[model samples]
Target: MSAHGETPHGAQGGHGNLNQLMAGFALAALLTIVPFALVMGEVEINRTALIATIMGLGGLQILVHLIWFLHVNRSAEEGWTLAATIFAVLILVIVLAGSLWVMKNMNENMMPMHDMEHHMQMEQMKSLQSQQG
Candidate 1:
C-alpha cells in the first residue's frame, strides 16, 4: 500500500511522471502541427507522399497517447490494454478497407453525365444508320 491507494501487485509502472507527460504532449502537438501546416500552407508535395506522411504522423500520435495519456503499457491490467488496442486497430483496418472497396466499386459502376451523353449519342447514331439502310 502506497500513498495513491492499494495498486494491484505488478501493476505500478504505467503511471508516468510530469516530465514524461509533458514530453508526450509536446510530441503529440508537433505531430499535429506539422501536418496542419503542410496542408494549410502553400507547400506543394506529391499526393501519395503527403498521405503517407500524414498517416505515419497519425500513428506516432496514437503511440504517444497510448504510452503517455492512456498509460496502456504491458504491465497495466495484465496486458488487457494491449489486447484491446490490438483489437481496436484490427476493427479500424477492416472498416476502412471495406469502405474504400465499396466506394471504388460504386464509382466504377456509376457513369458520369459526360459518359452517359456519349453512350446515348452513339445509340441514336446507330439507330439512324440502320433506318437509312
Candidate 2:
C-alpha cells in the first residue's frame, strides 16, 4: 500500500495509467478534428460515399472511445461488453436502414409527379374564368 492508503495497481493512486488514458483521449479528440473539418469545409464530397464514410468513421470513433475512455476491453467485463456492443450496433443498423428504406419508398410514392406550380396556376385560371362567367 502506498501513502494514500490504496492499492498501487488501482487507478485512484496511480498517475501513470491515468496520464496514458488522458493522452489517448486527447489523441482521439485531435483525430476527430479532421473529420469535423472535412464535414464543415466546402469540399464537394459525394453524398452517398460521404454518408457511408461518416457512418463508418463515426462507428470507429465510438469503438476507440469505448476502449480508451470507457475501458471496455478484454480485461474489463469482456464477454458482456462485447455482447452488448454487438447488440447495440445491430439494433442501430437495423433501425437506421429500416427508416431509410421506408422513407425512400414514401418519397417515391408521395412526391408530385408533375410540375406543382403549373398545376396550381391552371387551377387558379379555371377558378377565375368560372367567377367571371
Candidate 3:
C-alpha cells in the first residue's frame, strides 16, 4: 500500500534486496568462471570429471537465475511456474537423449576411415581407366 497500490508480501528490511542481488551475481560469476577454467585445463581435471563439474555448476547457475532474477519461487503464481519448469526440463532431457541415441547409431553404422579411403581410391582408378580407354 506504499504509493504503489500493490501489497508487498515478503519485503525484508530495506537493505536485503541489494545484498541478495549482489550475492546472486557473485555466485553466478563464480559458477561461470570456474567451469571455463576447468575447461581450459587450469584446474587439471579429467575430461569426464570436468564435464560433470561444469554441468553441476550450470545447474546451480540456472537455479540462481530462477530464484534471484526471475523470482520464481513456491509462492509465485501458486506454483504453476515450478510445474512448467519441471515439464520443460523433462522435454529437454527427452530431446537430448534421443539426439544422442540417434547420433551414436549413425556413428556405429558409418564406414570406417580405411574403407572410405579405399573406396575413394577405387573410384579414382575407375575414372582413370575410363579416361584411358
Candidate 4:
C-alpha cells in the first residue's frame, strides 16, 4: 500500500527489502574485512589478542548471516530454529572433542617400532627354550 505498491514487513521474519538487505550486506562485509585486514596487515598485534579478535569477529559474522541472510527470528517459530542450531553446534563440539581425545590417547599409548620388534624377539626366544626343555 506504500509508494512501492507493497505491504510493509512486520516484526515477523520475512525477506528483507533492498535497503535492509544492503545494510546487512554492508555490516557483514565490514565484519569480514576488519578481521581479514588485521591478519593480512603488518601491524604488531599479540598472538593471543589477534586470535581472540578473529574469533569474535567470526562469531559476529555468523550472527549476521543467521539473522539477515537466513531470516532467522525468535518471533515466528517460537525459537525452534535457534534451538536446532544450538543443538547442532553442541553435537559438533562433542564429536570433535571426542575425536581429539581418541587421537591423543592413541598417540600416547602406541609403542615405538623398535620396542615392538624387541618384544617379538623375546617372545620367540621364550617359546624356543620351552620347546627344547
Candidate 5:
C-alpha cells in the first residue's frame, strides 16, 4: 500500500481519472450537439425555450470543463480551487452586469437628434429677439 491507502498508479481504482475525462467530454459534446441541432435543424422549438435550453447547456459545459479539464475536485487543494473559481465567476458576473447596465443607461439618457435640433432652433430665436430689442 502507498500513501492515501491506495495502490500506486494501480488500474481499475482511485477515481479513474481517464474514464471521468472521457465521460465529461462525451457529455459536453452531447450538450453542444443538441443546441447546434436545435438551431440548425428543422425543429420548431419556441424561441424563449430554445434560448433557455442553450444557456442551461452552456452552464453544464462550463461545469464539465471545470471538473474534468481543470481537475477541480472537492479534495484538491482543500477546496481552494473551487472557492477561487466561484470568486472568479462572481467577479466576472459583476463586471459584465455593471458594464451592460452602464451602457443601457447611457443609451436611454442620450439626447436624440431631433431634441438637439429643437434646442438649437430655440437658441437661434432667442438670439434674434435679443438682437432686435
Candidate 6:
C-alpha cells in the first residue's frame, strides 16, 4: 500500500490527475466567455489592435488546453508537442498577416482614379452620341 492507502501503481493517481485536468479545462472554458462577451459587446475598439488581441488570447487559450487537457507539457513527447505548437503558431501568423496584406493591397488597387475617369468619360461620350442620333 502507498501513502494514500492504495497500491503505488493503482488508478488513484491517474484519477486524481484526470480530475485536476478536468478542473483546468473547466477554468479554461470559463475564461473563454470573457473574450466572447468582449467581442459581442458593441463597444468601439481599434480594428487592428482588437484583431491582434483576439488572436493572442486565442493562442493562449490553445496553449492552456494543450497543457492541461492533453498533458502535452508533461508527456514523453513534450519536445515534439512544443515543436508542433510553434509550427502551428507560425503558420497561423503567416496566414493571417499574409491574408491581411493581400486584402489591403487589393482594396487599394481595385479602383484607380484614372480608370474611374476613363469610365466616366466613356459614359459621357456615349450619352452625347445617343443624343445626337
Error of 6 at 2 (Å): 10
- Which of the predicted structures, 1 or 6, would earn the higher TM-score when compared with the native? 1
Task: Write candidate 1's Cα lDDT for 1-133 as tens digits.
Answer: 5676755443456466689889999999999999999999957999768867887788789888987888777764549879999798788768866876798799889999999999999999999999999
Model 5, range 3-26, lDDT digits (tens) per residue? 666676444334457778789889
Cα lDDT tens digits, model 3, 1-133, are 5666544643532224788999989999998998887767578768558766776787788888877777766765538988887787678768766876798799899999999999999999999999999
Better of 1 and 4 by lDDT: 1
Q: RMSD in Å for candidate 1, one decimal?
A: 4.0
lDDT of candidate 2 over 43-73, digit per residue (tens): 6979777767767777777777767776665
For model 5, where is the 10-residue window of minimal lDDT?
A: 7-16
For candidate 3, what is the TM-score? 0.65
Q: TM-score order of candidates, best first?
A: 1, 2, 3, 6, 4, 5
Candidate 5 similarity to native, TM-score? 0.57
Question: Is candidate 4 or 6 superior in TM-score?
Answer: 6
Q: Which segments of candidate 5 are over 4 A away from where they belong? A: 1-16, 91-133
Best by TM-score: 1
Clashing pairs in 3: none
lDDT of 6 by residue, 32-80 (tens): 8767876898448897777777777777787777667665653454688
* Candidate 3 C-alpha error for residue 76, in Å: 6.7
Error of 3 at 81 (Å): 1.4
lDDT string for model 4 (11-90, tens) is 34448779889988999999999998998895698976886787678778877888888887676554898888677767
Cα deviation in Å at residue 14, candidate 1?
5.2
Tell me the TM-score of each prediction against the true structure: 0.66, 0.66, 0.65, 0.59, 0.57, 0.62
> What is the Å distance of residue 52 in model 4 from its true position?
0.5
| Colliding residue pairs in candidate 6 | none
Residue 82 in candidate 2 has what lDDT? 77
